[model samples]
Target: MTKKVAILGAGSWGTALAMVLEENGHDVRIWSHKAKQADEINFKHTNKFYLPAVVLADSIKATHHIEEAIKDVDVIVFVVPTKAIREVAKKVVPFLTKPMVIVHASKGLEQESHKRISEILEEEIPESKRQAVVALSGPSHAEEVALKDLTTITAASTNEDASKVVQELFMNDYFRIYTNDDIIGVELGAALKNIIAVGAGALQGLGYGDNAKAALMTRGLAEISRLGVAFGADSITFLGLSGVGDLIVTCTSTHSRNWRAGHMLGKGNSLKEVLESMGMVVEGIATTKAAYELAQEKGIEMPITAAIYEVLYNGAKVEDIIVSLMQREGKSEA
Candidate 1:
């Protein structure tokens, strides 16, 4: 059945998902904060800055007014950054007269509260107006997905029917969806893996080969699973698509802004420079702060996360971090 869907945020990922929804034959409206961007998307059917050289479907419209975009939609997809969720939700609530199923593609913990994206949505959006919230995440990249690349992702929720709803909405010939009840594990896996991706980019920037990156990625998964398990997530979720799968793609792919930012950092560029150069939100940078703080609060030993935190926040040198990681006291490989 075709449903009216509102995708909040017109970034690359948002636009890409809009394409998927349009291809699936839904009435899709995308909300952009910038009126100019919305006008461009509607008039030209292209979001050049975000998704260059790709023509958007005419069925997918863009709106500057959040209330207008969401007023009559049956489903709402939040694709904005973690930091913008609260602000966007405030505007969204007033326009929601009926209960709407909520789906989030943002993969990051809130830097200030360390809350997952789903938690932030539930906190900001009133239960009376919102239906079930599903976490849609995995290793798929916006660029690849926009190209109709064969990609698989998961929609996780405590509510089985809700997740299945999302799965059906997004699944197609090129895109596949899986369902899981491990929302905590899925969200954490998606968020925390970015930190490791940055570390992987750093390895590449330093001219380290696959062996070193493989070691970082392997141990990085261990660190992510440790934190996820501490937060009451299923341990096995880490080995699945959202966990290890996301880590590998983000770490190695040129399409990952987090990896590119980390590469710049490893090559001695300032964080400010890297961020400004990319002009996109690098979710891993903020996630590193949140995960680092969470590890400290939980008394978990996450050496890799800590090292990335130091480099990002304390201006710690990349070379020193690499040396320190290599020189850690010998311990069991498990």
Candidate 2:
């Protein structure tokens, strides 16, 4: 069955997903905050800055007006940055007249509230307008998915049917979707792994090899699972696509802005310089702060996250932090 889908962002990921929906024979309209971006997408069928050298499907349309884009869409996929999730949701509220499957592909906890993306959507979008809130997340990169590479992701929601709806809407030969009910784990895993990705990239930037990367990734999952379990997430979800899978790809891939930003930082570039240079939202940088604060408040011992946080926010040297991490008291790897 065909569906009308409103994607509320025009970044690389948004454009990539639009391609998928267009290929799947759905009516896809993207809402960009910038009129220039929307105009480019409409006139040239391209989002040059975000998805460089890639032509978007001619059938996929874009508009700056939120109301216009979402007027009658069956599903609303929020792909904006974590900080902008609430703001965008508020803009969509007035335009929403019917219930829709509200899906968030943006992965990061809100820095101010330390709330997950779905929590912000649920808080901002009225229940009368949303049939269910679903989180679509995994290791899949926008670049790979745009190239029609084989990718698998998870659609998680408390409402089983809602997740299945998302699975059916997105799954294709190149892009496969699985359903999971662990929304808490799914969202948290999606959000928290970015922090570890930054750390992993830092390791690479410091000339560390696979052994170090492997160690960071392994212990990173342990701490992520610890904090996530504390937040009532299923422990096993950490082993699945949204957790370890996301952590692996984001940490190692050049396609990851978070990893690139961390690499810059590890090479001794300032955070401001790194951000300005990338000209993209590095989700891990902000996520480190949120996860650090949340962990401290909840008394979770996330040493790696704390180390990354100090390096990012406290002007701590990456090498010194690395040394400190290595010198920490030994403990069992449970």
Candidate 3:
């Protein structure tokens, strides 16, 4: 059955997903904060700023007004930046009059609060207004996914029926979807991998070899798994699509905003300078802070997260952080 899906962000990831839904014969409307972007998507059938090479389908419409986009929509996908999720969700609740599945492609935790995307959705939008909250995440990059590259992702929710609905909606020959009930693990793996991706970029910027990158990614997964387990996520979840799969792709890919941002930082640019150059939301910058705070509050030791946080926030040199990490007391790798 065809559904009316409202993707509440017109960024690259959002636009790419709009194409997926459009291909599936769903009525897709993308909401952009900037009216000019919406106009480009509607009239020009292109979003050059985000998906420069891909031609968006005319079946996918665009709207600047949230109410118009959400009106009678069966599914609302929040693909906005983590900072904007609350603001966007607030606007969505007022227009919501029916039971619509809430899905978000954002991969970052709210700063300081350290609340995952699903938790923020539950807090911002009352339970009565939404039918189910689903987190759609994995290793898929917007640029590649837009190119119709073979991609697989997981739709995770506490609600099995809701997750299956999303899985069925987006599945196709090139793009595949799986369902998982471990929302916490899937969300954490999605968010935390960016932090490690930044580290991977930093290593590249510092001209480190593959051995160093491999070590960083392996230990990065360990720290992520530790914190994830502390927060009630299944330890096994880290080994799945949202965890190891995501880490490998995000850490090595040039298309990753977090990796790009970190590569710049490692190449000796300030965080401010790096961010100014990217023109995109490098989620790891914010996620680093949230993960650092969460680790402290929960008494979980996340060395890599700490190193990234210090490099971004405290002006600590990556070299120094690496040396310190190397000198730390050794323990068995679990």
For residues 1-334, write the lDDT of model 3, one tens digit per residue. Answer: 9999999999999999999999999999999989999999999999998888999887889999999999988999999999999989998888889777999999999986888999999998988888899999998999988999999999999999999999989999999999999999999999999999999999999999899999999999999999999989999999999999999999999999989998998899999999889998899999999999998888998999998899999999999998999899989886
What TM-score would every model get versus the actual structure? 0.99, 0.99, 0.99
State the displacement of the C-alpha of residue 50, model 2, in Å, after optimal TM-score superposition.
Answer: 1.0
Give RMSD to native, each candidate: 0.7, 0.7, 0.8
Off by over 4 Å in 2: none
Pairs of colliding residues, candidate 1:
none
Cα lDDT of candidate 2 equals 0.93
- lDDT tens per residue, model 1, 119-145: 988988989987799999999999999
- Candidate 2 on 201-320: residue-level lDDT in tens? 888999999999999999999999999999999999999999999998998899999899889888889999999999889999899999999999999999999999999999999999
Total backbone clashes of candidate 1, pairs 3 or more residues apart or in separate chains: 0
Candidate 3 wrong stretches, greater than 4 Å:
none
Residue 84 displacement in candidate 1 (angstroms): 0.3
Query: lDDT of each structure?
Result: 0.93, 0.93, 0.93
* Residue 264, candidate 1: C-alpha displacement in angstroms: 0.7
